[model samples]
Target: MNDQTKTQAQARNDWWKGGVIYQIYPRSFQDSDGDGIGDLNGITRRLDYIASLGVDAIWISPFFTSPMKDFGYDVSDYCDIDPMFGTLGDFDAMLAKAHRLGLKVMIDLVLSHTSDEHPWFQESRASRDNPKSEWYVWSDPKPDGTPPNNWLSIFGGPAWQWDARRQQYYLHNFLVAQPDLNFHCEEVQDALLDVARFWLDRGVDGFRLDTINFYVHDKELRSNPALPLEERNDRTAPQVNPYNHQNHLYSKSQPENIAFLERLRALTDEYEGRTMLGEVGESQRGLEILGEYTRGEHRVHMCYAFEFLENRRAIASWVVETFEKLGEVAPDGWACWAFSNHDVRRHATRWDLSDAANRAYVMLMMAMRGSACLYQGEELGLHEADVPYEALQDPYGKEFWPEFKGRDGCRTPMVWQAQDEFAGFTTSDSPWLPISPAQAEWAVDRLEEDPGSLLHHYRRAVALRHDHPALARGDQDGLTCDGELLTFTRTDGEEEIFCAFNLGDTAAHMTLPEGSWTPLAGVMSDLEAGVMDLPGWGYVIAKREGE
Candidate 1:
């Protein structure tokens, strides 16, 4: 490549550094061919709509071959597309369309585990002496016939499932059908690296690694320590679930995980500008692990922790304190911020924010000091669906029931047209999941025409990030939460932007830092640059040029 072309390509690759990623959960996004389930062609068809949002990339959830045990997360085949989602050619078409629209594609890679139906797992379970027998985490049961350790699955019960054929138990951090791969096995790591390479060769821009922290385990199979109730938070698991009862020291977050990540990083680094965004699945020490994992350039590009997604109300003090903690822990590390995703309940309802509060947060995320992620339905301000028990499809919900419903509430089909019976997610009357009646009111067609809708607010907020270098990839400074107003400054080179948000029940105001500032247009505010008044759950932004 010529020098200028190489530089241009490099710049495009760097879009991930501080760009926004819009997540598309295929099963719920859009369905073509009347399958009632979304596919590659569905996503390709919506490329224009996605590109119009001004996002840098799209992070697609798993669509690999699976038994539908844990949806597509339980990969039966990593190299091929799931027939339900479409063929390999369909994926290629989707990639080409996304690239043509100037949007990068980041596919989800579930490397920590595989469905028992996977060829390797099928062979491994046939007998203990198979070539792939050691590829999965297998251990002998205690003579009395119990699991190898006290490890608990996030899905519930024991982490180990006894395989009758081999008379041994295999570890599974998630569903019993999904067995955790033994990362201790060099062969397994090499194989996953190859899976990553397969996608890179197919022209993927990056990856959203599922459960990145769970790749390695304590080889000795040590029992986890019981966490005191006060110390145990329902961030990793639901409150009613037993998975949150223990401190997962040996089960995951082993010191050896860094090496495997470095190896994966080295592989991605080979293809210039490709990035890795890992989902760190720890409740305690989540930010710590995220910081350590993304500390250096040799590791993954960035990691998102469950701190914001942990089902807690995102109050002003907590948000400021969390960022402060992250700043102190991993000042050099990059974080990918999101209020909601496929796994958690939609933040619009989870946080119970008012319309103004929701808009304020959109500004907060866009102005934050890291990359950002917007879940598929978040832009329309869709709340989590109330899927009745009879219609509940998530295995996790089926296990926990009553108190803690599964993520199916958040994973329901996206609403496209309000007038359509099924909200235009599919032509079939029966979608994989139900289309929420409440969400239909906020459907794309309805919101698309309303300039004041949350959809338009999202577009405007995103455009603001694109227009201001300080907001997109700036250095965050002077973060302070006073009363109900949280204030900070983002500086990129000589461009400095002052931002303030009132995340409270009452109106609030803040005094600007010592500088002449000009308020940015488009945002509603009764403003002079030096002092600003903010309503309950409101925000203001002003910029000052460099000296």
Candidate 2:
């Protein structure tokens, strides 16, 4: 290769620094064949539509071989594709197509654990004397034939499961079918690295590490203290499940996880430009853990927390304060921001927004400082679909019915057209998850025809991020958390952009900092109508003169 080719390769490798990643929930994105399940070919078919959104990359959720217990989170194989998705050739074809379209591809990596059906685990649990026997966390039961400790599973009940074959207990913080790896063992770490290398060698650009903090646990099996009722917040699990009552100390998020992260980082460093973004899953110290994990250049490149994806109201102050707190806690670390994902309620449903409020959040999400991840169907203002109990595939939902519905609402299939069987997503007999008729009407084809549609506004909002350096790589500053008005400035060297948002139903106003500013692309509906009056949940963008 020529020097120019090498330079171009290096640039492409550093492509994620200020990039936008569009996440594709594989099962719900598109079904190519009449199999009722979305596949690699389906993603390959939709590459043109994804590229049209002006995103720099696509982060696909888990598609590895799995039992689908946690829908693809429970991986049975690390080196091959699940028949539900497609073959290795299909994944290669999708990656090639994405690269041709100038989009990077990042696959989900479930490193903390694997499906109990995985060959490694199958071998590890068979006899206890096999070469892979120590790969998973295995322990002897207490003298009273009780669990090793009181560590509770996020799903429900004890985290430890008894295995009669090995005559010992194994740890699983999620579904009983998913066994946690003993990262405390060096051989296990080397094996996981081999799994990462398999994909890296296959030309994947990066990985979205699932449950990154759950790689290790307190080895001594110390009983976690109960959280005070007043101090408890049940965002992580079903409200009906007592899993939320205890502080998650001994179960997961152990300090030893950091050393293992360094090992993962070192492997990525070996492959020039490869990156990994960790999903930090702690209720109280989420950001603090994020900071520690990504503080140095040698660790994971970035980490995302559940803060922005929670089902809570976020005013301008809360938004600013969240980032400010992040800044204070993780000064050198990077964040990947997203309002919606497969695991949570869609932001539209959580905010209970009218269509207008939904449009405003599109602008606010893109304007925030950090890399943005746009979940599938979020651009069209898709809300949570009401999944009937009969069709619910989520075990969490089934376990905690009525009081808490699980993630089925957010996992519904994407709609591509207003008029078609399965909303033009598939010609399949039936989609794995049913599509909402209401959602089908808001499909991309219908929205594209209307110039003032939320779909068009989303394109404009995302376009703004690409047009201005301040929106993408700028430093956040001059933030004010006044009333419902959330205002801030983003500066990148000489370029400065002022941004403001009204995150409430009440009409709110804030005086602009005294300066000459040019309106680049105002996102507010009332702004263009000479109603400088900030309506409920509206945003404005202005470029300063000096900038």
Candidate 3:
């Protein structure tokens, strides 16, 4: 390749840095077949819609071979595609189409465990003398015939399930049908690494490692200590769930995970432009763990914790404090921030923000440092769909019932045409999850016709990030939080930009820093003379030349 070509290729290889990733949950994105379930072809059919948002990549939730116990997270086979989703051939076709549209594809990889029905787990549980006997976390029952320790499952109940075949208890962090892999075993780590290679070889650009911090547990099988009420946060588990009671030191986020992450990163490095985005689910020390895993050149490319996706409303102080803490904890590390995902309530509903406030957050997220992930339907300003008790499908929600209604609300089928049955998600009368009439109003077809819609706002916000080098790849500085007004500056070499926001329902004023600043396209505030006036939920992005 010519020098200019090599430089351009290197820039593309580093695309995950400050890149915008659109997340798609396969079951809810769209269904191509008449079976009411979305498949690989459905995603391929919607690539044009995804690319239209000016996103750099697409992060698809798990579609691997599975029994759908936890949707597709409980993998029965990592190498093959689920027949419900489509075949391996369908995945190749989707990958080819994604690349052709100039979009990188990152599939979710569940490495912490596998479904009990997976061949390896089946063999391991069959007998203590099998070749794969040590592939899963297993231990003898206590003398009283109870669990080996007091580790609790995130899905509720004890983390161990007694297997009559081996007369021992096997560890399961989530569902009883999902057995945690014994990462301490070299063979298991090697096997999981092979799974990563399989996808990379299949032309995938990267992976979003699911439950990345839960890969390794304390080898001693020690019980976790109780967390003080003051120390406990609802970021990882719901306030109603008992999983929040423990500190979770022994059950997950073990230090041994770092070496495995390094190994995974090394494997991905072999393939050009491949990135790893890990999900660290720790409530107390999540950012610290994210720092450790993504601290160096040899670790995962970026990691995201639940800081921004928590239940609390994000005021100006909260936003500034969160990133300030992140800066202190992971100064050398990188993050992929998102306000909503399939696992949590939609931000529009979770934050209960008005249309103006929601639009302000879109600009905030796009202009943040590191990278960003925009959940499916976020562009259309869709709220969390209300799923009745009978319609609920998430196992996590079912375990915690009324108090914690589960993630099904956020996982409902994406609306396409406002007037179409099932919102054009499927021709079938029944979808995996029902689409609410309220959600259908924000359908793509409806939003496309309205230039002032949130869909257009999202596109404009994302375009600003790509247009300005300071916003896309600069270092954040001069962060100052004044009550409900937050201001910061981003600088990259000679390019610098000042950003300010009013994350409240009251007017605010800010004195511009000394510079000849010009208002940018994404600004929503009024500037006069030397002072700037921001209405409720308003923001401004000004470029300061010759920094």
Candidate 4:
């Protein structure tokens, strides 16, 4: 490539830094052939709309060959596209189209486990004499023929399943159909590397490693101790589930995971500017794990935790403290932030909000110092729809009915047009989850014509961040925990911008830092009076004195 071409490539490839990524859940995004499931061609047809949103990239959830027990999380063939999604050729066409539109593509990779029917697992379980027999964790049950240890699965019950063929208990941290792989085996690592190389060779920009921390377990099979109620971290599972009862010492978050991550990073490093973002799900040490996973020059590029995603109305003090803790623990690490995804309730619905609160939360998320990830329909200020019990498909929701409805509400199909049948998503078949008339009214086609819509606000907010150096790629400082108001400043040398949020129900006062400043964005509440009158949830963005 020539000098100018190389420079352009560098800029285009450097899209992950401070870039906004739009996540597409393949099952609910779009259905091209109307098989009642979203497919590769469907994603290809929607690339233009994704680019129009001004997102720097697209993060697609798994579409690999699977049994769909966990809806594609349980992979049967890592190297082939599932017939439900389309063929391998279709994926390549989608990648080519996305690159043409200047959008990076990242695919979800579930390395922690595989479907029981996967060829590797099938062969491994056939007999202990097979070459791939050690690829999965198999151990003798206790004398009473019970699970070896006390590790609990996030899906409920113990994390061990008995294999009649092997006459031994195998570890499965999720559904019984999905068995955990033995990261202790070198061949297992090599096999997974080959799977990753298959995609890299196919021209994918990066990967989002699902349950990255769960790749290994404590070899000693130690039992995890109970967590005190006051000491419990509330971000792991639903409040109604007992999965949060333990400290999680044995099942996952093993130190051995770092070496495997380093290996994956080395693979990505072969292709210049390629990236990897791991999903760290530990409740107590999630941010710390994020730091460890992304720390140093040889590890993954970034990682995300459930901190902000779990807490809907996160306090101003909590935000400041969490970032501060991240800096102190893992300074070299990068973070990817999001408020909603296929796995959780939408933040707009989780946090009961009025007009001001809704607007402020969006600004706060965009302003945070990191790469941002926006879920589909978030730009339209969409809230989660209440799914009837009969319509719920999420296993978690089915298991924990009335009290804890599953994630089906947030996984509804995207709405494209206000008046079109099925919201212009698909014409021939019904969506996996029903669409809300309220949500359909906020469709992209309708919002595109209205200048004052939430879509416009999102575009402007993202543009402002892109234009301001202080807001993008800047050092964070001046964080103060003042009563209900949390204030902080982001700076890049000569430029600085102050940000404050009123994370409470009543008004609070905040004194400006020694000099005159200009209001930047999300100027919802008034700033004239010495005592700032912040009504409930309010936010302010101000630039420092002078230039």
Shift in Å, residue 161, candidate 1: 0.8
- Kindly list the per-residue Cα lDDT of model 2 for residues 1-547, writing each as its tens digit: 9999997997666667667899999999989987888899999999999998889889999999898999999999899999989999999999999999988899999988899999999999999889988899999988999988888888888899999999999999999999999998899999889999999999988999999989998888888999888856655765577887888887888889888899888888888778898898888788998899989887888899988887776767778788888989999888888889888888888878888788778888778888889999988889899999999999988888777788999989899989886898888767898889989768999988999988888888888998887888789887777788888999888888888888888877656666777787655344333336676876778887765
Clashing pairs in 4: none
As a TM-score, model 1 comes out at 0.97
Model 1 per-residue lDDT tens digits across residues 1-547? 9999987897776789789999999998999979899998999988899999999999999999999988999999999989999999999999998988999999999999999899989888888888998999999989899998999999989999988899999999999999999999999999999999999999999999999999999999999999998898888788888888999999999999999999999999889779999999888899999899999788889999988887777777988889989998889999999999988888989889888888888888898889999999899998999999999989999999988889999999989999999998899988989888888889999999999999989999999999998898889988889887888989988888888888887988777788667776334454545566677887778887443
Off by over 4 Å in 4: 1-14, 504-507, 524-538
User: Could you say which candidate leads in lDDT?
Assistant: 3
Give TM per candidate: 0.97, 0.96, 0.98, 0.94
**Model 4 TM-score (2 dp):** 0.94
What's the residue-level lDDT of 531 in candidate 2?
A: 37
lDDT of 1 at 89: 96
For model 3, the run of ten residues with the poorest summed lDDT: 521-530
Cα deviation of 492, candidate 2, in Å:
0.5
Q: Can you rank all candidates by lDDT, best first?
A: 3, 1, 2, 4
CA shift of 362, model 2, Å = 1.5
RMSD of each: 1.7, 2.5, 1.3, 2.5
Residue 496 lDDT in candidate 2: 88
Error of 4 at 174 (Å): 0.8
Task: Please list the residue runs of candidate 1 whose C-alpha ends up more than 4 Å from where it truly belongs after superposition.
Answer: 1-10, 521-526, 545-547
> lDDT, candidate 1, residue 284?
85
